[model samples]
Target: MSLSKLKLTTCLWFDGNAEEAANFYTSVFPNSKVLHIQRYLKNGQELHRQEPGSVMVVEFELDGHRFVGLNGGPNFKFNEAISFQIDCANQEEVDYYWAKLGEGGDPAKQQCSWVADRFGVSWQVVPTAMKDMLASEDKAAAGRAMEAMMHMKKLDIAELEKAFRG
Candidate 1:
């Protein structure tokens, strides 16, 4: 069967802390919630279930994307190769996300479009008007806006528009 036809889901593997991480994520994003949780038990006795309180699997949705969190033991870690991008309308949105996600995490400078959160989850927080401006017929304006954007940590839509007009 083709992978695309197999009801593909993004499965996140956590180091024995799937439940905690899921809850944390749901709290951070709007319209997010933990859909269901499953526990592992053996025979008549709950082995991993009764100890350490690890979650076998947690189904959740963040900003409408369905994801599964598995307490698969710390066999892997999150990397920047894959990341979630947030398109914001203003600086307030950018700052809010930067502060919330950057807590306890390192931030990598990527102009006004990117930041890596504490959990090694990289995010690109960009202005919603970026596409419109970049697609403008005015090449000089688009280039100027792009230059301005490349120097910011958090995108400012107003500033970009100003640059575009210059």
Candidate 2:
């Protein structure tokens, strides 16, 4: 399906590596695949400078969300401001995502469960339990969890729960 059909879709800009990025992302997430790839034609080759048959945009689905990766060159780059949060069902799921997504990423950039993949795309591997603790009306418990979270890179669910209960 095309991204236009969705009410909202995220589009990522890449420097001629959209295909590789799409493939990697699909491999990391289950129930995901590259939906369609749009290639540049001769008509805009003059302005775009990309080869006529080169990739222009790669449309893919990660889990259930659709995303378009555009080979728009080096004008822009991904940053820490925006990130996709993965809500894991348990500590095992959180650990799995953390290891897969954090591979070859900048260790210095990792903090509070946020990791920037090798592609420079930031992702937050959050435990599903964290939501309840953080949203709890008991501000002290929420504060404790938040404080505990601030001290860690990959979040420890047990630690957060202990802090919350204290």
Q: Pick the candidate with the highest lDDT.
A: 2
- Tens digit of per-residue lDDT, candidate 2, span 104-157: 888988999999998899999999899999999999999999999999999999
- Judging by TM-score against the true structure, name the best candidate: 2
What lDDT score goes with residue 67 in model 1? 91
* TM-score of each model, paired residue for residue: 0.79, 0.93
Poorest stretch of ten by lDDT in candidate 1: 44-53
In order, the Cα lDDT scores of the candidates are: 0.78, 0.94
- Model 1 per-residue lDDT tens digits across residues 92-166: 887787777777766553446777765566788776788789999999999999999888877778898999999
Clashes of 2: 0
